[model samples]
Target: MRKHVRKLKDELVKRGLDAFLAIQNTRYLAGTTAAKAVIVPTDGPPVLICSRLEFDQAKREGWIRDVRAFSRWRAPLRPGERVSFCEPLQLIADCLRELGTRAVGYDRGGKKFVRKLRAAHAASYRELPELMLELRKIKSKEEVTLLQRAAKIAMNGMRCAAESVTVGRTELEVAAEAEREMRIAGSEGTPFPTIVASGRNSWLPHASATRKHLRRGELVVIDFGATWGGYASDMTRTFALSPTKKQLTLIGLVKRAQKAAIGRVRNGAKASNVDKAARIIISRVGYAKFSPHGTGHGVGMEVHEPPGLAPDSKDILRERMVITVEPGIYVPRVGGARWEDMVLVTKKGCKSLTA
Candidate 1:
């Protein structure tokens, strides 16, 4: 927690701002209207202004420094009062003004308060969503631990998915099995909808699980992830319900490509280089056109983060950074094959944390 605050402070200094205003409403977390208001000031502890009703809950979470109540009718106004509806934002802005903050940074999508602040005070406001993105790009030790836990839950789900691969089993059945395993393994929920595509359906990247039954000698693509403690772990593994010569061959190619991509990951390597390393092998196997998506992406609080491994991405790999190395090939009428693994960038090479 202190580390996150320090990082936010450093960002404020870098951006020449005195503080940051983080405004979040419903859809931010569990769809609650008592939006969270956080004021991260440079050179001191951060303050979290939450609805009076949520103050106790936030304090219990211990994710922030100071937790203050924003009320409408008591001294500050009570709950169910119209005045309380307007107190949080005004208090936040007033606090900034008192700190002599002339410029404040924020993430995007708070136009209402931005307009109000601009109208009331002469303070210049800047939006730096990217700053928050960059700060979150590198995971801390606690974050890495949580991600490891998430990965374990995902691996459990993967094991369940692998076991569910069999002739006549519907795609939805396989997906449901994976989801049940994730929940039993302590995952809050699946990070995204589980993808259980068999045979032709495997060719679709984000194919929704359906009732189509699996067939012998067909490939089943299981793309899934689980969320634990707000961190996400993504992985994909293709299975052959009944082995066929051609299916095994394509899976081998994709596995090789994924291995090559993971082998190329290291500190200071260009994201594009890792992607190219995988694409080259897949292309050499006469499947260039079949490979659609980028190799992988950074995994963290969000399923997908910065430093995407793509041909056009300029992100440089850094030590301690965790990312996915997934390479896939889809043959239109045949089937698709992909192998994904979460890896941690290291000084010499990379380690597959989810392996």
Candidate 2:
């Protein structure tokens, strides 16, 4: 069994759960996102339940040995597996009944799943609060390697952006160029839509790329992320066309703020402290109003996960936790500048994965 599964099983025992159902976070436990649901019994081997179409793929990629399928297209059955055609919900309930589990735990994503399972099974279903988050927050050595590869791909995309962005080029054109480069560099896919905002559009933090032509002396914010092997990396870089003094200053301040936030990412540091470290730097220069978003967020299977670097966040930093330290300044009618990078939290400090 994978270490992730062992950790979950240990937690299941502590919570007095006979079995734990996973609809989401299947990728975290078993390196495959193909499984629709996974059941981890406290005393027996875990089982992966996927659609018949995905059965072969999940069996090939999953770490666990027991993989079952539902919603028929009739794949070859394993030894002693007689039932070949069962509805997904009935199969799930049957599996729990076979395990003789009375109390089952499930993630937040299993609300509807549990409701349906309750109608079919007599097992008690309860939510496991932050169970997957706690299990996936820490990066194993292999997970870090995958994240590093993702970061390298994202960096290649940014380099493409630098070469492609020029006066008169449409924002969409630049974004397309960067995305193509990332694909060529071996990214599984983009974690989120690429953000290539120029001029007034850059003033919006989550601005979508448009057909607007890039103008001289306008700031361009390119936020992009690349995924590899179910891991993700996020990064942002600001470019100036003709280079105004204000644009340069904004870039410099945001960069410094990002650095400050990253410096506070060591183990045991509070997530709010990291956000404050960046906020204070930008606020000192009277750009506090211009900075609306949080300092950053955790980057993993999903681009935005846990351990958020925001003022109201209660998460604490821990070693091997991968996160992004992003700081930005957006002035209305002027433009916006953001600096973001993925970092790995360590005991002494954090290492930049997307420098």
Candidate 3:
């Protein structure tokens, strides 16, 4: 927590701001639901404003320095009475004003606070959401460990999903089996809704599990992920319930395309180049129109992060960055084939973290 505060303070200094305010709810971070606010000055320990219910926990966790409790309005005030309403925005503005702060930096959401500050005090504020995002893009050592664990859980879930595919099985039943495997493998839950598209339903991107039964000689796409330790891992692997010659050909083409994309992902390469490599392979096989989404996206604390692998994205690949390389070709009413893997960008090349 102190390290994060220092990073925020450094960002404020770079942006020429006096302080930064971070308002978050405990529901966002599991184990607590108290609303909390932190004030990070350029060169000092962070001050925490939290409810009475969270003060003790925050202190024991060593998350901040000052933990002040908010009070409610009453007819007769008690000895330790404080402000009635602890609206994060108003409290932040009041703190800044008291500290004679003229300029501040914060995440880009507090519109009411900004309005009140502009009207009451002639203060200037800068949005520093990008600064925080950039800081979070590069994973720390501990973060990488957690992500790797998530990938392993996801792989286990994928294997269960594959085994669940059979003739006369409903999409929902397969999804339930996958979810059960994920939980047994130590995943808190699925990162997103499990996609158990079988037969014709496999053609639709982001298809929800339905009552449709798996048919013989039909393709099934099981796109799923698992979340562990607040980190997420995403992977999509298509299956052949009892595939025909045509379905096998499409799956083979998609696998080749995904391999081509993964091969292009290395340190110092532009993300767009990876997308192009995959697109080239699919286009050569006459499946260019079927590929709609980007090649992949960064995955960690958030499922979708910066450095998207797409033909138009301008993000450059960097070492130690974890990302997904998924390539697909979806044919309407027929089926789609997609293969995905979690990769860690290395100095020389990329390593498949989940493999």
Candidate 4:
């Protein structure tokens, strides 16, 4: 936690800001997702703000010692003010006012938030663009451990999904089975909604599970993730009860494409090149247009994050970054197959964590 604060302070120093305000889900910094806001000043300890409802929980779970709770009912007015402010933004503005902050950096907010903040306080605000992304992309040793555990848990779910898949079963049932297995395997919860797209539904990469039953000789794309200690890992596998020649070919190509993409995941590797490695493989077989999404994405606290592997991406792969290599080919009215695996970027190459 101190290391994260120091990094934020360094960023603040570099940007010439008095403080950085974190209003979004900053579990990566505060060690608790319940924190409503974290005021990271250039000096001294950072302050964590929580709602009166979650104050005790945040105080117990958060690493920041200076935890405060605010409520309109509990606020005391000093002047001829008729009533206390109800919005939590007002409370945060009051904190900045109390700190005498001249300039503040914020992680996320829209025009309304900015206007309200400027109206409430005297400080100038600047959005710290992608600062959190820069910090969250690199996984520490402990973070790697958590992600590895998550990968194992996700693999358990994947194995369950593969085994439970059969004709006459509903996609929702298969999803439930996989989710149950992951929960039993010590996953806190799923990182995202468990996907069990069978038959034609598999044509859509991000299709949701439905009551549609699995049919023989049809492809079922199961994409899911597991969360462990706030870290996440994602994986996808296509299954078929009775495979056809086309299905086998599609699976083989997607698996090879995923392997090629993973092979490109190393320190100093271009994210676009990694995407191209998979794209070119699928393109050779005239399935390029069938694959629309990016090859892969970073997986960490959230299911999808920075360092996207796409043709237009400008991200560079760095060591210790955990990302997914998902290469898929979806054919309209036919079927689709995706093979995804979580990989840990290394100096020389990358190691598959979901294998």
Using all chains and alpha carbons, the TM-scores for the candidates as numbered come to 0.91, 0.95, 0.88, 0.95
Best by lDDT: 2
The whole-model C-alpha lDDT of candidate 4 against the native structure comes to 0.87
**Clash count per candidate:** 7, 0, 0, 0
Clashing pairs in 1: 72-77, 72-78, 72-84, 73-77, 73-78, 74-77, 74-78
Give the per-residue lDDT digits (tens) of candidate 2, residues 1-355: 2888889999999989899988777888777877777898999888888877777788778887887878655666666443448787788888998999999998855567668888888878888769888878888898899999999999999999999889999999999999999999888888998999999999999998999999998999999989999889899999999978888999999999988888788999999999999999999999999999999888889999897889999999999999999899999878899999999999999999987
Instruction: Please list the residue runs of candidate 1 whose C-alpha ends up more than 4 Å from where it truly belongs after superposition.
Output: 24-35, 71-88, 110-113
Which model scores highest in TM-score?
A: 2
Better TM-score candidate (1, 2): 2
Model 3, runs deviating above 4 Å: 23-36, 49-62, 69-84, 98-100, 117-122
> Which ranges in model 4 have alpha carbons more than 4 Å from their true place?
75-86
lDDT: which is higher, 3 or 4?
A: 4
lDDT of 4 by residue, 1-355 (tens): 6677788889898989999899864677788887888998998788788766666677678888877766667565434223224677887888888888999999999999999999999788998769877888888888899999999999988888888898999999999999999899899998888899988899998898999999997999999988999998899999876988988899999999988888888999999999999999999989899999999999889989998999999999999999999998999777989999999999999999998
Q: Rate residue 274 of model 1 by lDDT.
A: 96
1-355 per-residue lDDT for model 3 (tens digits): 3455666677788778987765531222222234366667786666666665565666566545455555543345446534436444556566666667778776655687678766655678776676666766667777688889999888888788788888998999999998898898888877788898888888888897998999987889888888877788888889987678888888998889888988888889999999999999989978889999999999876788877999998988888789999888888766888888999988888988779
Superposition TM-score, candidate 1 onto the true structure:
0.91
> How many pairs of residues in model 4 come into backbone collision?
0
Cα shift from native, residue 171, model 4 (Å): 0.7
The Cα error of candidate 1 at residue 343, in Å, is 0.6
